[model samples]
Target: MATPRQDSSPKGFRPAFYRMKDVIRITSLSRPTLYRRIAAGRFPAPVKLGGRASGWSAQALQAWIDNPSGYAAEPTADDPAS
Candidate 1:
């Protein structure tokens, strides 16, 4: 049997994404709160991974975590849904 490999990559190696659960865990924010902030453009918007999947940029989230007060509000898009 093959064993599962752990995350042994070096830092700044590649793009890292945080799913909803990880995002919540890292930010300590509830799901609804996260979504609300996203809608309000007060938080980093998540990237669409596919038709039904989405993820947040780990770098962006880490930056926000490092300096919450200095974080800039995301620009609003022309689309009403955005």
Candidate 2:
């Protein structure tokens, strides 16, 4: 049997998937404002988890948290110019 791979990151650390309510609590942004920023490419877009469910990536949220003013959504392959 092979030993399990170990994560060298902080204990209890894992990629978080934050729901709308959690995101509101974390960023203190209203739903409308959050949507506006996402539309403007000024914030990370939430990923679809399943039917009628979506959430933001912790890494993406961290980028915004680190520099809210300078944060810009990274272009994805879906983007025309990307």
Candidate 3:
């Protein structure tokens, strides 16, 4: 008899991080617009993944998706309060 495979992640779980391309695709915002929004504190900043690599948190992106116009970036230790 074959054993059943077990799934570790929760149901409907997605990747915890999204690359810039993924973010742009999900938000339907151009690269420039995304950067501008991030600079203006209207979008979530991506977390550093490693050398020269960064990705946005799925939770953060989902929050923005739920309320785009009202979305505000939360300050992180790497970012200075403005």
Candidate 4:
């Protein structure tokens, strides 16, 4: 019989997924504003989790929080390097 695979993650290293409420709480932005910014590409987009659920990447959110001025400075795969 084949054994099941184990995650075996180290303590305190698990990634955290923040819901809309959590994002609003941490960023202090209203729901309408948050969604508006997302629509305008001013904020990081959330990943679709299911038909009715979505969440932003915590790492990406953290980066924005860390540096709001140059948050979009880093070129993305679609953006050409300059």
Return the TM-score for each candidate structure.
0.68, 0.78, 0.78, 0.64
Please report the TM-score between candidate 2 and the true structure: 0.78
Cα-based RMSD of candidate 2: 8.3
Mind giving the per-residue lDDT tens digits that candidate 1 earns over 1-82?
Answer: 9999888988867457889998898888999998887776667888889999999887878778888667765565765655
- Candidate number achieving the greatest lDDT relative to the actual structure: 2
lDDT of candidate 3 over 26-76, digit per residue (tens): 989999999999998899988899999999999999999999999988876
The runs of at least 3 residues in candidate 4 whose Cα sits more than 4 Å from the true structure, single-residue gaps closed, are 1-15, 73-82
- A best-first ranking of the candidates according to their TM-score comes to 3, 2, 1, 4
lDDT of 3 at 63: 92
Q: Which stretches of candidate 3 lie over 4 Å from their true place?
A: 1-11
- In terms of lDDT, model 4 sits at 0.77
lDDT of 2 by residue, 1-82 (tens): 9999987899877557889998999999999999999989999999999999999989899899999999999888898978
Give the Å shift of residue 77 in candidate 2. 2.0
Report backbone clashes per prediction.
0, 0, 0, 0
RMSD of each: 3.8, 8.3, 4.9, 8.5
lDDT (C-alpha, whole model) for all candidates: 0.80, 0.92, 0.91, 0.77
**Deviation of model 4 at 71, angstroms:** 2.5
Q: Which structure is stronger by lDDT: 1 or 3? A: 3
The CA root-mean-square deviation of candidate 1, after full C-alpha superposition on the true structure, stands at 3.8
